[model samples]
Target: MDPTHSTLLHRLLDATTWRAFDVDAEGRILAGHDASGSVQLVELRPDGARVPLTALPGAVSGRYVPGSRRVVVSHDAGGNERAQLSLLDPDAVTAPLGEDELTPLVRDPDHIHGLVEVLPTGEVVYTTNRRNGVDFDLVVHRLADGTETVLYDGGGMVGGATVSHEGTRALMTRPGRPALSSQVLLLVGDTTTELTDAGEHARYGGLEWLPGGETAIVTSDSGRDHLGVAALDVATGHLTWLVTDDAHDVTARLSPDGRRLLVVTDDDGASRLAIHDADGTFLRDVALPAELRAGVADFLTLPRWSPDGTGLAITWTDPATPADVLLVDAERGRAGVVASSREPLADLDLVDPTSHGVPTPDGETVPCFVYAPPEPSGSSVVIVHGGPEGQSVRSFSAVVQALVGDGHTVLVPNVRGSVGYGKRWYSLDDVERRLDSVADLAALHTHLPRLGLDPARSALWGGSYGGYMVLAGLAFQPQLWAAGVDIVGISSLVTFLENTSPYRRAHREREYGSLERDREFLERASPLNRIGDVRAPLFVIHGANDPRVPLSEAEQVAAAVRANGVEVEMVVYDDEGHGLAKRANRLDAYPRAVAFLGRALA
Candidate 1:
């Protein structure tokens, strides 16, 4: 590995990727590009020209207003995730847009106003916890009159709302009592009706209303372990299974014309796309490029359908390639790059991962993607994904590539409690069973030899919940790992639940176990509690203003481990939260961490 972290990691970080979010009527694509150091909204013109929509320190996402010429942009402060909604008129902005060009629609730094959908009637449906700071209420804001109305105050965190085509009604989601599940609600003329059965705790999302609004298409795990697309009747609340995969989860979206359905299957971690009729009749599959997965910048959601419905603008990428939006011809059944986010990194050899399933001691299989370097580096890094419910898929990761390029093998594991496999797999390590997922780390190390990696020379790396896994791995199974890098991870579950934002406490308690009822278990499961057991060198990275895990989580863990006479390096970014958003900070931070890894592993 290069002695200087800047040389190797600098070039790797320099390679940027653009993601297409929404396409306007004139074929101008609204995308998030990192060419300007931070991810900002850009308008990709038809004639190869580009217009910058926002210049901010944090990343921004926008969607074209259904019936208006303006776009609705969602921006946040420092990565606090307290989203503020604004309207941006492309014509009104200069070549490089300033903050003043955006007209604030919902501005409250203290509260979160997340963008849900923009109705054709020039109204925006969003969810905000401003009502009480504990429960999020669905709100409708009219751009014309600047009138705001509380759509639904469900007494809990209202997950998301999808407005109807005519804009008279909306479908909302409320987090269910069970983890990885949600309750669907239909709101029409001030009346909200429950759609899914309350008894059955199943995950429901990607709700799209049919032409007449009688039947809606949704992706759910209602009666099955795997997520599948189903036709939901609003009146009767009966669901007719449209497409189901025995192994992997699948999501579907209704095409604009309402004649075809675009079904995307999560085959392992990669994606496969297929077209189906409205009735679930199988149509021809859209062949994607080898090794590439079909998705938008937002990995979970399906690609955006063109306004005419004759084509689709989809984002495609693999472990080796950056994301680029491709246009798929619905009739011709072919794909071509319409808006390219591919950078000038073709000269660099980006490593691709091969899928593998490691068997755990408890007869469960942990899905992982192994990225092996061309040359043997002796040491390996296991990157754990956050969400505990989030799955590590085969996608382009600069960090993974940089580490592999530096000659260290990287293993991304989707242990128990990760989505995309099935509901059963994600529920394996819930609440009292949380440590079972951490045990999967030792299981992964035990099976490392099968993949020609040494367990003794391994390290753990992750952020958020994954960060917790890293700390847990180093503390609980101290002998297995050589080093650990925890980014905004929870050191103590007890503190995490107590210090987390009020709006998120109850919702997160559903997965991590309640602070009131399970305080003892939370303390026992906390890595900070077991810091005395840790022997490996550690590197802690955190944002000072992080509202999720809180900076104290990082501080206490670092202080505890350092007091034990073990080497601990802590890096805190003052202007960030949860994760580093700016490329300048990333260039400094990631390289330093990698440099630390090199020394610790050596």
Candidate 2:
């Protein structure tokens, strides 16, 4: 590797970013800072002092206990994704958390027990699969008596649980028919009722109760193409659409007072934040910084309101800046960065991607973000995002920046199966139509020349489902891609469904087609079945403890391709599961992959 490229990759991989997840009444922010090399929960005090909270091996996520000074910390062993819940007292700890300091709330490694809500009455409402490995049940653990009550055991997956303000009722979300659509089940005293019709094809989530808990605000696309914020009546499953948009999906966050609402619109992967009254009357649009976007997806980051509702704390990011917490004055509609991690690369100029829509063979347009370097290198990379349901948003990425810095044009596309486009677009590649997404890669390659890139020197790169796309692209269209990089990808859908975690199988099968019903189709869709056609040199990365896509997937495909006398490089991290979360591992793995791509493309 060139000395300058090596230094650039090292610096980009080592750059630390801070994210604020929750804030308290005292203005203390519970933030995720990777200054310790791994993301750990740190208390950002109002006095500008940062106090380390938990120092675990895996990345930690946390939220402050409602109406209490104590915090609930959630972490997993390595990258297994079976997150365990623990509690910590930030006021009592002056240093990083010791082994015994974290009070075990739910500590079982065999199954997942996720924290839903910590009520003021010392009851923790969580979902766990302790009853059986496949199904998740909502249970309320009372800290006062050490007793537990199963709130809703109506089978399938308890996607989410939220307790009412009075603690007399709860709402649990269950997976709908297509898995993308979710149905809400309301629990009042001992009776449970479905808030959403079982026959509907809509998705409902982001449920927040108003003052008395009689009516709650939720984001739903029940009878529409795009998601919009609506108010749902608890007594009857009546929905009153609040913020409806013909073009984009909008999510709403109610203020602490329940008087104001902060609504965010997903305008083609970017965020547009606005404030609305309780009745959905438009107040004013928040004047955000140019190109600085707020949370587009709930999991990416959420805009949190202060306990008093006077200020808002949002995780904002642009192409050059990492996710940072910005405290906004709700009354004035102005914001400033309260916690940031942009100092490390302050002087370095990073590449910014321009959004474009590549036309597919069927006249459908695939949205893509292209990162072109200032000088042409004749080589380009097509990076696919994992979540067949996930979108490639305009967020900060060190890998894209490093690749562009090394003179490689990168194209990030949201194919047919990607979310944020609409229900029709996402469902296009489901089950039997799986290979249609793989075809999008060839379309992207054909359009590379329009962007001043040589189609013959292009490569494929992705992780998880994206990794599957990479393998599929190289295998299905061998002559298009020069080389390919797959990280934690699925090689065989048949083996993937067979070996993936039990709890995930049924849910994933809804999208990929079940093993019992569609075994032959899965075998046909698997990249391993067509591995003999893969002429490009390949690099595979995987995690040994991956529960979703087992290590066998990577091993089988690499071995099969190598048998054909093709060059193959494989790297497996014992400490990782789905993807590389540790900085040290990323610094080690990404540099080699980039070098391989450089040589292969050359």
Candidate 3:
């Protein structure tokens, strides 16, 4: 399942996902909980593998305790605003690690936010508290005696803890200045040794120690485009990149034989997996596509390959298709769909093929898709998704359905840089031509009227980076529509990155350009600098407590656009972060957006 194209369900369910993955002392599959509280970790067939958690309760986070075979899972109970975390034994039966029993005692009026690791000698839980606009330090607990410890303080982000094969060294991420371009540190017995230096915002976050603890594998960047594996000398602190010049990302697993590496990446905008010699050279290419590129929260997850590195499996689905798994030959990259999650969904009835494409300024062609309930006399809305990295899928979308239900036609134009396209297409979305996507967006609107779509009924809406695009479209082409929605989107690239968390400090360098280093470039690409030119009935949505694209971002435009008396409306949700995760926020928001777009563009 190479993702050169896709189905719809991929958009429906992929907001973010988590599955409980557990392995035994010998590194074999023990149990997996897609949801929790089923017969847990019952090792039924193999010595290293435990039984699967057949009945999952739609958990969002989980962890496997060491020494023991128990796994803990977390979920936000429906109708309840709080989160619940519970422990599950191998039989899929669960036991709550109540405050009295669980380490890193859950916060009152709040819940735990750590991955539990049960080691042979102790139970370790990693959680954090914030300070000075940053995730200060992580608090760790040793459950063997219910004793708590602060392993790494606010100066760094500590995670991906791996005990050496000998259980002597614990390697984890140590965030450095200017954000996520962090280093890997090893706490051996008593000494804290640094294995990497803070480089461009790339992180040495994902780490795996060699079986013998002689070396470690970490991830960093090459040419500001992709993440690659780096082999490090645990004893000397020396490191080197494993791949070059191809937008690749990796999670390397040391082979049981101690002489091979299993890696995954979408090096060509097409999924790929490879096995390399212990020395960082390619030995074999593995078959994996969708899973290798699936987004979980803000980053991509690398599926766990078989212990022997002989085979691999992953899951993927899109709007017009059902979820399914892919299994393949690890060395040769030969692959095939192994299973479907459910019966295939009925395909959608697409209309007027002529309405499906947008022409870019450079004359490149892009595809656009529109869906609307039968509305003979109503307005239409054009939507751009965040992550110029994202594309509108053929599947069901909560927002899309809500808009259509309210008599609004929704259009998704995959202006270049959206995945599922080739490398050149995706790269075209880089900094200098940032507005090209918005330009293509306008072409779609112009193309619509020719297809019997009313231009007077059209408007634009998007969130995050897409929201930035929405604002950009209206700023640069004020006559495109009648209204727009900008949700927690960036008003200025320069300031957005300047105050953003370290996690994205490095990304801006490649995505747009550095604020301190490339001030002019950043300014040129941002819409805030040009907000004075925006003309529309703008309703801005923002999370006052947002840590990604901060609330100030929306406020800047709200203040500026309103000062100009452009009919700008701004709404803020303080409890929300980068998005409206709380139910009340969503319920109130959906109706408000419909009303706003309806009244203005109506």
lDDT of every predicted structure (CA atoms): 0.83, 0.86, 0.57
Q: What is the Cα root-mean-square deviation between model 3 and the actual structure?
A: 8.1
Candidate 2 structure quality by residue, lDDT tens digits, 27-70: 88888988777789988888998899988998888888868888
Q: lDDT value for candidate 3?
A: 0.57
Candidate 3: lDDT of 435?
A: 72
TM-score (C-alpha) between model 3 and the true structure: 0.63
Model 3, span 52-125: residue lDDT tens = 44242222344456556565554433212233444555553354333233322344324324453444455554
**Candidate 1 vs 3: which has more lDDT:** 1
Give the winner by TM-score.
Answer: 2
Error of 2 at 447 (Å): 0.5
Ranking by TM-score: 2, 1, 3
Q: Write the per-residue lDDT of candidate 1 for residues 498-543, one digit (tens) a residue.
A: 9998877888998999988988999999999999999999998999
Q: Residue 160: error of model 3 in Å?
A: 5.2
